[model samples]
Target chain A: MKGRLLPLYVVALYAFLHLPLLILCAFSFNSSRFTVWEGFSLVWYRMMWNDGALAEATWNSLLIAAVSTVLSTIVGTLCAYGLWKKNSKLLSGSLYLSLVTPEIITGIALLATFQWAFRYLQIQLGMHTVILAHVAFSIAYVVLVVMARLRTADPALEEAALDLGATEWQAFRLVTLPMLKPGIAAAALLAFTVSFDDYVITSLVAGVDSETLPMMLYAMARRGANPVVSAISTVIFVGLGMLIVASERLQKA
Target chain B: MKRLRALFLLPAWAFTLLLFLGPMLIIVAYSFQSKGIYGGVVEPWTLENYTRLFDPLYGVILLRSFVMAGAATAGCIVLAFPLALYIARSGTRKSLLLNLVMLPFWTSFLVRTYAWMFLLRDTGLLNSALLALGLIAEPLPLLYNDWAVIVGLIYGYLPFAVLPLYSNLERLDKSLFEAAADLGAKPWEAILHVILPLTAPGMRAAGVLVFIPCLGAYLTPDLLGGGKSMMIGNLVQNQFTSARDWPFGSALSLALMAIVMLLLWALLRRDGEELL
Candidate 1:
């Protein structure tokens, strides 16, 4: 990064990463009769709004993401807390396995388990199953991110709180929990975003009825690269960017 | 008190044990069981699924998956190490760059991937741009082949590699380079002798993170690899969906898990040694 090349290096990397996405956003509003851009217009965005099926899928995705984010955060915090106390090499390795294990393996394995177990429980797949799958991955991620944060937090602060007559839960709520807020917020947003965007695992585990945004987008893209899909992607991008900004603002507040 | 300390980890242990390890064990067992004609596990057990898993056609696929994953991992490391070094050198400004790297994620994975498909195809951006520049008389064949799949894979997994290496390089004992220089070692030699060895664990971590997932990657390869080239992931998917060979799919799933576990073990062992 010396002389003339430094800015060029940055430009090249940025272009490599974002050029396609910029093109997609540009075409989303394109007034053209085709996929390629003719001129900017909001017709496709209007079309996206009017599509009832797309609207329903959007609702499903939001609900799934919210429920999954909350569930995963709770479970992940508990799981990370549990692991933090133990601190055994053996347990650490096992925790890492959950993160490293491929989604397909977990998806199919859980499908088989659900098929066998839930038949008696009478649970046919739908939003619940999709949430469950999303939670599964989210919890692993939550555990990982929160654990990293927890490691940097001082154990003595909790001990001092306890020395001042705080109970374990009191120490946790008064000190540890407040300190870990940013990590939790980060983990929640990240988990929600990932779950909202997932396609393959959701496709495998979900029943016939649960068509998340990604599932719809995948079908649309597969059949043909429909122009409306660009509009949908634009909506997702702007919404996620807002959510991310809101999360950061929350952390600062 | 020690036992009480153990109690804290119960949730993590239980989560990993039940969801992670338990499902893995189930995959192993399910793979061995006979496929019931009605699309579930049969009463009888057999190695029929595992045997078919090793059939020449599938074997080629398994091999190709290794090659693709290896290529992707290499691609990630090459770009990641240099990029991470530069960013870490840039210090506080690095976070901005890191966030920008993650901006692709504001869009859906499907959308990001589809954008690549649109750009790399015959009449896509690179070809059109190149043709406009008269850099080439004909459009470059850039999409729907091994190279495109590799590009897509590297694109998806780059941040994973970069993050680990950045921190790893950033935390390096700066004095080590000074010591190497004092010992008359050239800058390259100093890096090779000190920095590379120190960052070996991070490199291994990045490799495992990138390679293992790349091996089982379903979307990038399927979308970009085209029907012509596929990995074990697509095969497993087919067995479950199109092929309707649940038993075979189960076996392949178990095989995939095994490969992941093995790599994880190797990585952790190396990481442990490196740390010590």
Candidate 2:
């Protein structure tokens, strides 16, 4: 805590965190198929752009993330609002459980549930299943983010609106909903990030026709370290990094 | 009006019940059934799945997963403590540092793991650099092992460890440090005796956050450990996939949930509800 060594250690720690990402980005431009330092080229980026399955996967990921984020944000905001009005220990407790539970278990449980239900429903794991799974897991995060904002908000505004001869719905819609927009936006951004980045759960519930971006990335990674994977990753890393920073700014605002 | 208020919770509750809780219940029931001759589940409602977990094959795996997850949790603490403290004490740079930490948390974890894979592979960046620098005669066998898995877990979960500790440190009484200094304690002594004791709860929270995920980690071990260093997660995955034994998979998952839930119960009892 007291030496020049501390500053150096902090720098090294940041290096450990950021250096791999920088390297991946840099190598993404390398022309060689292997890791050797070849001349700079956009070949991998072009290949990633041209890959048909990869394009479809990206579309699927976006669609899933968009739908799930909207669904979870609406549901979670309402749930958090209700809890704020009158706390339910059981409800909030389960939300915490969803957050803490590991992805593998959740993935398997949802998979099991889908398979069991399919016996009667006559459907297979597909985009709908993955979207539902995303909503199920992501509702907790949205609720937490919104609940944090709700706790800081003054409840008296809604009460004042109600006392002024407004209906309860009008009071909430006019007073509370306006105050919650930024939090809802932040939570929606977070939900989208979580849904898009999810691999394990998405993989389990996605049928062959519904592969998401992370599933495709996983397949490419498993095949070996290719420059195409690096290119795609660099794009995602930059995109999501901006999204998160924007969410933080929104939360602060 | 009260009933109308409850309607706000209806969608969330129905979604949770029909999807999350309902699936969990299905797995719990399946755990008590036996493996069907073909694949799924066939029930006389036997406890063989849980009993079979006592086999030494799984015992070794469960033990190894515990040790590796523990090692990763400890590593995250060691690496994150100073960083968290540094961030808590900094002024203008504090928010920037916090953003940097959360950046990886929001991005694709699979991409970051792939970054590590790109570095650690035999024909990868680390080996390529070392060979170029003449640091070694041959490439070190860095990937596809227990150490790789441990390192991956630590890297992936380090941000989770840092944020909790930082939040705790941010709330600490700065006067305590000053008092310790006024009482003639050196900086090291103040940190050891004063700061360390106060941050213990935060460390526990960080431990729970990191350890639970690390214990049930599938992708990290699967990609880094490479079929060799199998964790309990991988074993459970195998049962459902390649092994085609859903009942055993359910039992394994239940066993995992039990361990996680027990840990959560202890933490909640000790720390109230804020640990999440």
Candidate 3:
């Protein structure tokens, strides 16, 4: 009885989880504007494709995610290695602070920081400011993920390379870098996803011209239900789902 | 070699210090200052912003945020516990079950929230299906309310609650249960004394994970509650955006942080170190 009931419960839970997404995808193909069933159609998808603002937002999101991923991955991997070499309580504690801090708090704080800097620098709150904010919060995640990976790595591997007449840099480059590749990749993916999905912080720090996908989606959703929004959501859902699956495969490899 | 490694750490440290810590410190300073006539901060310090937090309007918003967040957390716990237990007990399908739980989380949060809006709106799928079934004469007022906000919150954070509880339960010692059985304790008593105490840490972690974000959630209430309900997060955003009251916003942000810090401190005190 328990065994039979368990699978039923699991199925029910998963149904609850995925039903909304599935419904959204289904409605995007419905010809009618309302939620009632209509004949199949691709009109909403075409409308979404034609949306210039959304196209711009997607481009901005991709660019920001890409730049921030590269920056955070490099800085974070190095920092993780440093922390591994010498565990500093203060450094680790500060990393924890970034992880635990609410998005709104981080958003406002970064917004204020940018505004303060812009006063003297004469720079605007555009893609650059958004990138900087993305890099700031994203580094913590990369550091944590890489640090966890580093803990599992053998310190002797690097020491062995060192004793084999290789220079310190060569030992790190050849041995430690290869070992940390999986971790670095995972961190990059995490940073990318986070940067891509972020709304609160991006909305606060982003200039009017630098809106990201989430920002656009929020704006559209606030206005009202549009079938085009559903179409865009389906694209995002499929795209992100593929990315996650690919990353999971990479981690396993 | 040690010096070289430390050198590698400098960039990250400098970035975080200049950007993360420095901005947070700026917020702290801004919180103490007065709001300028135009928008930004002014020189002379005052606790006026914090005092304004206690006013009835803001107080009601704050109280409503807590109530909604608390309700969502409670709902997640109740729903997640059984699901997590089932996943943990499933011998062969555990990883698959866990993955299913997490799959939705990987999607964009705003997208997910929007999906919920589509479901709960008056002409939404839920209402349509119910109407077709003759469950009601008219569409029920599902969206643009506190309950709708709670549903969105719970939907977003339920996985956070589940994953932790599943992990803790997965690691539970079956031998302990066997021992309890041999001692002739009732099943309920065994669960109460053995299982519950062991899973307390995960429960606490789940509570923290769910509650903190829920307390600061803005998108759910804004989209699902149809602006009828306002939370602390919405209030803070308004201060920064529409209201253009930076000092007041900073003060509110600091207040939220203080509450989070207090919760963390309490958890640290209870757990005596590592928090998940």
Candidate 4:
């Protein structure tokens, strides 16, 4: 009786977890303005496409996600590699601290720092600050993911490559690099998704001219139920869904 | 060779020092200074910002945030444990179930929160369906309350609770359950005496994992609670934005950080310095 009931409970919980998002996705295609469906249409999607601010936000989000992902992935992978080579309790502890820090605090801290520094430097918060902040927070995630991959990797293979007269760079490039490829790819995907989805931090640091997709989506969401918001959400939902699926496959590969 | 490996650590360390640690240190400094008349911090380092935290208004907000986060963490543990057990006990579908749990988490948090807003709004889907079914004359106040905020927090952090608990359950020795059974322990007794005690660490970890995020949650309360259920996250965001009180905001940030560090220190002491 217990065994039979447990699975049923699991199914119920999964339904609770997934049904709202699925319903939202379904309503994104509704023809009418209200929740009561009036048959399916692409009207809202059309509106999302035509919105100039949303288009600009999308461009900004993509640019930041792209640049920050590359930078964080490189830096984090190297840091993970370095840690693997020589363990530093202080550095690892700091990474964990950053990971566990609340997004609000991090956002404000960065905001305070920028406002203070920019006063002296005569600069302004914009896409540059957002990108910098994204990289800073994202590096911890990348390091954690890549470090998990490194722990599973055998050190003997690298030593063997060195014993066979290959240089340190050559061994890392030819052997370790190929092995780390999947982990690196997974880290990049994680970083991109995080940077793109970020609202609190991005909102705090973003200038008037640097709105991202999430910052825009949030404003629309706050105003109430707009099908245009749903339409954009569906786009992001499907887009990130595909990316996560790919990342999972890469990790398994 | 040693120097080459050190080179690999340079970029990350520099980034951390310049961006992460430096900014945090600046907040510490700002918290002691006075808020400028306009929007920035000024000289004359003082503890006025910290003393202002004693105000009843900020105290209520802090207490509310604490209670809401605690309630949400408890809800997540209750909901997550059964699901985690089922996933751990599953044979062929364990990985699939695990992936399913993580899928929603991987999606945009704003989209997920918006989904809840779409459901719980006055004229939203839930009310629409209930009204169509002759449930009530007026739409129930489903949105913009403490309850709605708690639901959102649980939903957002449920995955964080599940993964750790499932991992712990997976590593348990099955023979222990059989041993309990043979020793005259009933099913509930076996779970209470055997499984619960053994998996306490995992549950503790999950509690911290869920609690910390819920404590600092901004989007859920802001979007779902509609400013009715103000949290610490909202309080901090408000100071930086409309309040335009940088010193006060910095002080609030430090207070929040201190609470977090207290929790982390407790967890680390129990787990012996390894963070998952």
DockQ of each: 0.51, 0.77, 0.72, 0.84
Q: Write the per-residue lDDT of candidate 4 for residues B1-276, one digit (tens) a residue.
A: 588688899998998898889999999998899878887888999999999998999999999999999999999999999899889888899989999999999999999999999999998999999999998899999999999999999999999999989989998998999999999999788989999999888898999989999999999999999999999999999998999988898899899989898988898799754334
TM-score of each model, paired residue for residue: 0.89, 0.98, 0.95, 0.98
lDDT of model number 4: 0.91
Question: What would the per-residue lDDT of candidate 1 be over residues A111-227, giving only the tens digit for each residue?
Answer: 776676576788788888888778877787787778878888888988899799988877777888888888888889878888898888888878877898999988886655567
lDDT (tens digit, per residue) of candidate 1 on B1-276: 344446555655665666566766777887888877777777688998888977998999999999999999999998777677677778679778877776675447788888887677766667777887889999787877888888898888888888888888988878888999899998778878888888887898889889988999888888887766788888888887777777889899888888888887787677765533
Per-residue lDDT value at B200 in model 1: 80
Residue B104, model 2: Cα distance from true site in angstroms: 1.1
The digit string of per-residue lDDT tens for model 4 on A96-178 reads 89998999999998988888778889779999999999999999989988988899899999999999999988887888888
- Model 3: share of true interface contacts reproduced: 0.71
Query: In model 4, which runs have C-alpha deviations exceeding 4 angstroms?
Result: B273-276
Model 2 bad stretches (over 4 Å): B273-276
Best model number under lDDT = 4
- Stretches of candidate 3 off by over 4 Å are A1-4, B182-189, B272-276
Candidate 3 residue A162 C-alpha distance from true site, Å: 2.0
Interface RMSD of each: 2.9, 1.1, 1.4, 0.9
Mark the 10 consecutive residues where model 3 chain B has the least summed lDDT: B267-276
Candidate 1 residue runs with Cα over 4 Å from true position: A1-7, A88-92, A245-253, B1-18, B105-107, B127-141, B173-199, B273-276
Q: Once model 3 is optimally superposed onto the true structure by TM-score, how far is the C-alpha of residue B245 displaced, in angstroms?
A: 1.7
What CA RMSD would you report for each candidate? 3.2, 1.3, 1.8, 1.3
- Tens-digit lDDT track for model 3 on A125-195? 99999999999899999998788778888999988988999987898789888988887897888789888
